[model samples]
Target: MRTSWSPAALDAALENVHRAGMPGLFAEVREGDRVWRGAAGVADTATGRPVTADMRHRVGSVTKTFTAAAVLRQVESGRIDLDAPIGRYLPELVPGERGDAITVRMLVNHTSGLAEYLPYAYPSLKAFPDLANTGPQSLEDHRFTRFDPVELIGMGVTAPAVGTPGGTPGVYSNTNYLLLGRLLERVTGTTAEECITRDVIERAGLRDTGFPTGPYVEGPHSLLYEAWFGMIDPPRDHSVQDMSWVGPTASLISTVADLNRFYGMLLAGEIVGPSSLAQMRRTVPVVSQEGKLIDYGLGLYPMEAPPGRDVFWGHGGTVWGGGTLAAIRADGKRRMAVAVNMQRWNRLDSAGRPRARPLDDALAAFHRVAMYG
Candidate 1:
């Protein structure tokens, strides 16, 4: 049975998130024709503008879902084969036997065993033992720099593989999606941005979601603050930066409402066909550095709901200075989209692993309200 959303409870939860350290938060909950929106804290610290549900924010790696969908669309059209090795499409770029062994499916499921390039590309974090926990200081010099996807993939391919392609547990790598983006272009003979826009965004009727060609977000949006654990300074405004560094993988901007609609339609089999959707939901156990097991599919993550709540399927994304969480119940009866205009919520321990902080509690509270309230 589905429960009606309690606006009062949701409002209180948003307030707690603001008090817990987020500069601002905007969220939407939808069940059939009924929708509820809420916000708290200041969108701009200088002017103290309140965040609104319609405000656009960077959705980060959630862009992968769209990319995956575009690829699947090509597969359905017979332009691309899921099991074919990526080297078949981009042999010049993804050379060697390892490339030949890695299939399109492996890339989407993060089983390609590719190393991420960000840590090695940035000079500041070169000595940081764990690149996964690299902080904002590492990116300060290149925040506005434009990066070519080919160059990014070159850096990653030069690094050692995490494991044998398709033979080991998935290790999350931004490089895999970067390559996938290139593969999409190779197969479609169109830019990744154009393909995603037409195939996913337009098809889903998401008016507020887009791939920005420049650093500025071109609509009402919250100021993104990065608290890099005092590495550069706390609550530094990083709302604008050239996102080309993570192109096609983590560079899409969207609003809570649009995100909810996208996920709702996606899980309902509106975006991709039944066969492709089933392939997307096929799960593999991915063990994180913290030793937690997460079930990851093609581009989606299946998050088990709290006790007594229905399981939700979707994705969560975090960029330099913002975060997004979008999910819908398996039955498609309930959906939620939440965006926080702050990043690096958890403090890094001496080993460079994230440890719990106030922001974690705020996120948990927001999820509880969105999923179970």
Candidate 2:
């Protein structure tokens, strides 16, 4: 332990993020046997409902970690091969040379060179590839839309490859995870949600974490507000929107405590075997959806760390108005899981790049104290 676990310091850090324009947020920080949970701001601006640490939240692509863990469980059972091409399991979905060229490991690590399907599926969000463009119109247009995973896979597969398979600086794409979802179904003869829930979520005993059954998040939760970088003037509440568009990739709803628990067990070799965990810790360069190169592993990535600070392994995810980050120190002792009700704060520059904001530094400082202290 650091010999200095300050609950007041952690609370102040969480408060700083809220002061930096976060609508609402909650977090859980653990140090050895001690645990601290905190929340700040309002859950609903209209109603002024205060946020709480126990609220369930739409945890975005953090679902990838659970999905990757499920795949590794299958690997342990001899039902799947990590190095084998995805085509072997879902040929009809990822056919021919492209499928043969991309392996399960590549897909898990985001090195498969698949272009993101978001720009294709939500054409309005084309502003994504070109950050200077504004397109929150499609967000509301498809709020209730239920997209088929196979159709989304087609959009990404048919799109031009971002790079060669097994290449460095891999582009992060939800399409690769969508295919992994289908592969899970093809092998387990069940929905990807069911397989992951049974194999990883249930195995880890995450009571507040599971795939959303529909447009509504069950149990108590905060209203999610999306800023869209000022595209939507006042920001809009997307708390009840359907999440099928991201499905097994980013649709899981959970809480801060559950997230911390999941990572703790995951790092302790309780959720996956030692070999599988080692493979997950193996890092490679991959371009994150945010357009920055990050050290990504199989469904996991190290949160950005300052020089001389200990590295933390986990994942961060965002969907519309919500975002969550769950990370555990490499030594598996310190951990922090945070969920925010607001997202997309940075204003785009002339070249479509997001300008740095005080909020960014505020959040980073919070992570530093939460994980290291």
Model 2 off-target regions past 4 Å? 1-3, 127-129
Worst 10 residues of 1 by lDDT: 126-135
Estimate the overall C-alpha local distance difference test score of candidate 2. 0.91
The TM-score of candidate 1 is: 0.95
Write candidate 2's Cα lDDT for 222-293 as tens digits.
999998987777889999898989999999999999999999999999999999999998989998877788
- lDDT score, candidate 1, position 15: 88
RMSD in Å for all candidates: 1.9, 1.2
Tens digits of per-residue lDDT for model 1, 320-353: 7888999888888899999998876566678676
